[model samples]
Target: MKSRHVIFPSLMIIFGALSLYFISQFAEPRFQDASVDAKFFS
Candidate 1:
């Protein structure tokens, strides 16, 4: 049946979730102030 084509949404959800996770994993945290010395101590 043509209903078998419904796999696209499932694939999209899976890929979207993975993409979000991968993006967050590589995202750099921005500091509110660049003068913070805690960044260097960490």
Candidate 2:
């Protein structure tokens, strides 16, 4: 039971890191339009 607590949080942290990495890759700029383009936050 104690091990379950540690494992769950570790898995969540790993998944979050992976998600951010992919988002950054997909948000790369590909156009001159400052108002419309792939962005991490827009």
Candidate 3:
């Protein structure tokens, strides 16, 4: 029962970190523009 206190927060922190890392990596495009040509040329 006591372990649950530590384990739950640990899992939450790990999950949050992984989620943030992945979001940062894949969420933002290198090219801010939406059009293909603009992005390709810019």
Best by lDDT: 3
Q: Per-residue CA lDDT of candidate 1, range 1-42, in tens?
A: 566678887889999999999866654453334546337635
Residue pairs with backbone atoms closer than 3 Å in model 3 (clashes): none
RMSD of each: 7.4, 3.2, 6.7
lDDT of 2 at 25: 71
Model 2 misplaced regions, further than 4 Å: 30-34, 37-42
Clashes of 3: 0
Model 2 whole-model lDDT (C-alpha atoms): 0.76
Q: In model 1, what are the clashing residue pairs, if there are any?
A: none
Worst 10 residues of 2 by lDDT: 31-40
In candidate 1, position 18 carries an lDDT of 100
Global fold similarity of model 3 (TM-score): 0.67
Candidate 1: minimum summed lDDT over ten consecutive residues — where?
A: 29-38
| TM-scores, one per candidate | 0.54, 0.69, 0.67
**Scored by Cα lDDT, where does model 3 land?**
0.78
